[model samples]
Target: MNDVIRAPLAFRNQHEILNMHHLIIGAGPAAVTAAEHLRKLDPNCRITMLAAEGVPPYSRMALPYFLVGDIEPEGCYLRKREGHFEAQGIDVIYGRASSLDTVAKTVTLLGGDMLNYDKLLIATGSTATRPPIDGIDLDKVYNCWSLADAHRIIESTNEGSRVVLMGAGFIGCIILEALANRKVDLTVIEMEERMVSRMTNAPMGDMIKAWCEGKGIRVMTSTQVTSLADDAGVLKVSTAAGDTLDADVVICATGVRANTHWLDGSGINMDAGIVVDDCMATSAPDVYAAGDVAQGRDLSTGDYEVQAIQPTAVEHGKLAARNMINGNATPRGGTINMNVLDTVGLISTSFGLWMGVEGGETAEFSRPDRFEYLNLQFKDDVLVGASSLGMTQHVGVLRGLIQTGAPLGKWKDILLVQPNRINEAYLASAQSQHAALAAA
Candidate 1:
């Protein structure tokens, strides 16, 4: 025989009440936007945002400009003022979420407290990945990912300081511009054959390399940094090509990795990132993930890919919030994956997969003396991708063409006849969907 404890009539309403607490696990743009959206949908809902970083979220994309002193600390902030999130009915917890209990629907904070919630959103962004090199933990070796890292580099920089930057990606190029502006002896070492190799094609890479060199920044390609040693007060960086460079500081801009360690043992599907469906829902019920941590589908390749850009993150947050509030809304379409690196005076923009050698034929126009190059890649008689260096006026047209999978018939003729004539029939057909949206 078992005795059962029943709830009293007065306490019966507790079981029927819905717990509308929304717990967001990050403080970056994605999490912040998601909180705002949730608040708009349900003003009385309990919204708690957990951030591993102590300070509130700031514009990390502007960190290079901040390092160059082009923008002050206050200008880099995304929030207009302090307590702005609080005014929006968001409770921010400045502590790392150590673990997740999916069964209990609770997040375990570092301080031995568990937050139970009806719905949870994992928007923990990414962290800079430091290469596994000897002496990488030296005091002078730094990674420019956070606001603190930017401050460290800015404080350590000087007129005659020799700074060795490892990796020549977008961030690396921006750092080169920032350091060169300070008149520092800047040397960039990249493992790739050319600068921004992963992002841009060969022609665009050459144009950017020339631009960097024109600004007195030494761009070293096909090189790998093997080790870093603190020689007295100076930092000695050894490269794989048997070359060594001395520097006052070493900035590693290799790349970033998804911050998903908290999901370990939480029964969430993760492969390099949190695996979410089209609606940004996790394997566990009522749990969602977005931003850099969520490996969403890529439109160009139709495969799950991690897009760590800010705009994609913001859009993902908005879409996730809509799906959460509306029960099951259609997932938003993926972005075309565009990157614009405005370093010094050079404006380099690359869209989609512009370097698929086997699947496409490339049509290029280059004015080496003018420092302008454009490469258009076509596959199956459709414009698949495009890259523009030192010229961006035609980027919008190219993006529209790529997004709509516009046919490449007579494309070369149109491009040669009047490059600015993007309002022609083919281009108009490519932008019909956008036109429809605008009309609506």
Candidate 2:
């Protein structure tokens, strides 16, 4: 009788192993995209997503529009349809992963629930970096990252409110425009030498600073907030430059760090982020990482780096999902360094290695009077990178040319003389390539 009972239990355990489970630990675009693809590829597989925020998956990029009153909170949802996740059979569990056990293939949530998986994806994304400063924890000071934070900001801020924005990096600059729309007395402070120092060159940064000033927004570069204090029911922001400003709200957009703390001692190789191969697989077996958490290859530089941009995230998700199901059949092309900024009415963009590589040539044109500029970087006759200000016409062409790595032949010389003729060059180069292909 004992042997008969043991045989039945053993058979049930084997059946459970046959049913595959794909567990994703995030709720961002990458996470949702991967889940959807996984279901499409393997209809019978068990798909579960761990949403740490305990809310419906929403786009952080859309939060600014929410702040500007352009969209309702529901509009921020990645899938606005009712029962979207349910209809797709993707189970979303509202729990934060506290620890990962790669060998056991289990993740422990904060509430002490251990979930097992046949395969795992780490798409935990990132969190806003908060600098250590006195009174940094004071009331009304918040990082406008999540839905909860957005609610606090909306409640604390109003028209004519005194708002002090810290850091003028990519995230900060994005939030700046929404604040400006709120008609608040806004002041932007950056520790870098110029605005968006990492993404834009000196001339472009200066132009943005000047443009913001012209719009009546006080732009302070090379300035850092030293501390914050409560001043008669208002917030006091003290800067490193010996200046203090009183504010109704202090918005900290300092920076962001990858959400990889839970993977410590999990034997996963990580630099600034989890190092991923061409297939988006991590060092551990049966484990993958994607989106902002995975530092993969840069197509232009051929280096592994975290792009943290939406395009990169979405691409990473699709590639990761395909490879997960198809056994490394879909390797990533690479993640491009890309940014498109809209500061008030001025538009600026950068692609790939915008800050020219060594021994590379460049073609540039600028009309500071009209606040328009274009700079193109090249290696031999191929366009490698580009930057532009207040010009929308050449965006699609510039990206297409650089991404395709088209040989310009004589077009390179023409661009050096008249970089403004990028449109013509693109058309000619494309026609020539088509002709060559037809002849071949």
Residue 267 accuracy (lDDT) in model 1: 88
Cα RMSD of all models vs. native, in order, equals: 6.3, 5.9
Task: List the pairs of residues colliding in candidate 2.
Answer: none
Candidate 1 lDDT over 158-262, as tens digits, reads 998999999998788877778888889988999999898767877778878888888888888998899999999999999999998999999999988999987
Error (Å) of candidate 2 at residue 276 is 0.8
What lDDT tens digits, residue by residue, belong to model 2 across residues 204-277? Answer: 88898999999999988888999999988899999999999999999999999889999998999999999999
lDDT of 2 at 45: 75
Return the TM-score for each candidate structure.
0.90, 0.92
Off by over 4 Å in 1: 1-19, 81-83, 356-359, 406-413, 416-427, 435-440
Clashing pairs in 1: none
